[model samples]
Target: MSVKIAVLGAGSWGTVLADLLANNGHEVRLWGNSAETAAEINDHHTNKHYLPDFKVSPKVVATLDLKSTLAGVQAILFVIPTAAMRIVAKQVAPILAETGAKPIIISATKGLEQNTHKRISQIIGDEFPAELAEGLVIFSGPSHAEDVATHDITSLTVASQNIGDAEWVQAIFMNDYFRLYTNDDMVGVELGGALKNVIAIGAGILHGLGYGDNTKAALITRGLAEISRLGIEMGANPLTFMGLSGIGDLIVTSTSVHSRNWRCGNALGQGQKLDDVLANMGQVVEGVGTAKAAHELAQQHHVEMPISESIYRVLYENANVQDEINKLMQRRGRREMDFQR
Candidate 1:
């Protein structure tokens, strides 16, 4: 049974997902923000702006018109950047409801909404009420666009407000190369997606410092602590942080050279400014936006995430990056093993 899947934001993530569905026998409609990009994808079957190396599926329809793309869409996979999530949602919700009927909206995006600190699901709930909107689902994990596009054996979690929602998503998204698991913990899944970027940056800084394997391992382990603490304060189940979405994502992002955020941080570690680093990077670095959101949330919730706080300061407050690193190393001493030790 072929399904109609609309993938919003023809960026790397969206392009990869659209290709995945199309290859799996589903009709995939890719909505790109720019007309030129859309035209290129429609004709060339490749997203020149993003996923250039991966040959797109001929079944994928890349379009400039959102409504036409959403026509008969059963599920919409959101691959928009974190900053644009709300804006895209607002524009998409009305058009989706009006274009025949809106599909079950699934956010594949990661990161807290800046300033407001809203999660992706919260943004969806606010923009599309349950009555008018299809039930929302979130798909996330250690999966990276580069690896996923290559048909790597990536595992992911599909979570929603309820377990049934997750189960519904798991059924459609699971495939041989991509293993999908269901989680009832939306906060945990969202937090895992959002917070891992921050840790990846930290890992990059450690790599910049020429730190050994011991230091990198420590950063990932402690980074999970930061996510768990902050997520719990924000109403997510504490245990969710220990699962695939949490520690799994952190390990992958922090270690992978393919991570945009890690690459950006590596540039920063080598003495590049934020703007210059971003300008040089060809793709979106999710952690850059995520650091700001984490900082704002830390202040609001009073969670002590020194590593996240340090990265936030270096990223936004004009604090010296190396100086912050030294400061983190010299923090009030305790045992390195347990939380609050």
Candidate 2:
């Protein structure tokens, strides 16, 4: 069955996803804040600023009008940055109420609110009514926009509180090149997606500092351990961290050049200032903000996350990257399998 979907965002990931849905025979309304991007997508079938070489499907309509974009749509997918998530959700709420539209909410954005430490789904739920928010779906995994643009095989997890909602999303997004699995552990799935960005920064730091495979392997291993520890303390399923959203996400984001977080961390590790690194990236490096939120969450829960803590200091406190790395190496060793703080 064909569905009318509103995709909110025009970044590389958003454009690619909109095109994918259009290719799958869905009517896609892509909304972005920039009129220039919207015009480019509609007139040229391209989003040169984000995905320079890729052509957007002409079937997808790009617009800056949120009200029109949501009009009669059955699903809305948010691919915006975490900082903008709440504001956008607030705007969408009144519009939905006016239209009486009960669309399925899907969040592809990954990051906890820096102030409240709430997940993306929680933020959306806080803005929208219970009826519209109850079945919200979270899309996450190791997939990257660059790879997906070229039709590289990509698998993702679509998790929801309601299993039926997740399966419905899986059906819409599944294709020969794009595969989605349904999981009901929304808490674990969101945390794994958000927290892995922080670990990826650490991985990029190691690479920027000229560390080899052995050191990178150790950091990734230890990073997953801390991520799992904090996640378990926050009411997430332990086994979920072992799946696609957890270890799989960490490995890809940390190692791939396509990751904005990894690239930002690489710039910082090379002694560039945070402001300069961010300005140059032209995209949001989610890890920079997620590191702070993860740090606060760890403190509140009394969880030991030394790697994330060190990353937080390095990014926010003007601490030297090498000095932080030294501190991590000098910390007291514990059992490899220990989850207790």
Candidate 3:
């Protein structure tokens, strides 16, 4: 059961996903903004700038023209950054309407919108009509592009408002090396995916400051609590935070050397300027922007998220990293509170 899938955005994640689909015997069109990257992927079957030294599947083709890429697609996967989701969705909606094609739209991007603080699926739903947007699915977990590209065993969750749609996504993405489980809690899944990045930044800061596993473990544990609190306030299931997209994603992103957010925060904790860290990374550090959105959302929802707020200040307010760390440690301790409250 091979499907023609169009994967929008050809960053490292997008390229690796497209390659994975191609390996699964599906025809994949990877849409990239850069004509040079498209040419490189098409002609040489390599995305050197992103997935350097890795040979992409020949079945995976790359193109700069969105219209051409969407011409005969059966399913659409949006893997672009959160900031670009709306603009790209707006562009795709008219074309999709004109083509009279209704594909199961899947979003793999994880982040809340800056000003609106909407989830990626909600942003897509706002741009596209109900027919195509209502069945949106979110694919996320602890899986990293670098690991998946190397055929490492990776597991993720495919969450949707509709169980059938989630199952459908699970079927396509599941394989020997890559496996997916279906979940109906889209809100929880998306929030868990988006919120964990802030904690990962904190973890990286700990690493940059030469802290050991004890400190990292404390941050990861407390970070999960903060994410779950805010997520519950925003109408998410508390149990979802205990699953793949929550603690699982948190562990990977916060500790993995491949995580852009961790790397960016590590550089920052080492006294590098934000501008310098971002400029040198050559990749989007989603947590930097997500931290701001999380801080705003926490304030609006009246949820106390000290860790996320501290990361936000360090990233945006020129707050000293060590000072914020000290403040977090010196905060008054309370009796062990129930997370399910």
Would you estimate the TM-scores of all the predictions?
A: 0.94, 0.99, 0.98
Which residue ranges in model 3 land beyond 4 Å of their true spot? Answer: none
Q: Which of the numbered candidates is closest to the native, going by highest lDDT?
A: 2
Error of 2 at 56 (Å): 0.5
RMSD of each: 1.9, 0.8, 1.1
Residue pairs that clash (backbone atoms under 3 angstroms), model 1: none
User: How much lDDT does each candidate structure score?
Assistant: 0.83, 0.93, 0.91
| Model 1: worst 10 consecutive residues (lDDT sum) | 332-341
lDDT of 2 at 339: 96
lDDT of 2 by residue, 127-197 (tens): 99998889999999998999999999999999999999898889888899999988988899999999999
Evaluate model 2: give its TM-score.
Answer: 0.99
Which sections of candidate 1 miss by over 4 Å?
99-102, 132-134, 335-341
Worst-scoring 10-residue span by lDDT in model 3: 332-341
Clash number for candidate 3? 0
Ordered by TM-score, highest first, the candidates read 2, 3, 1
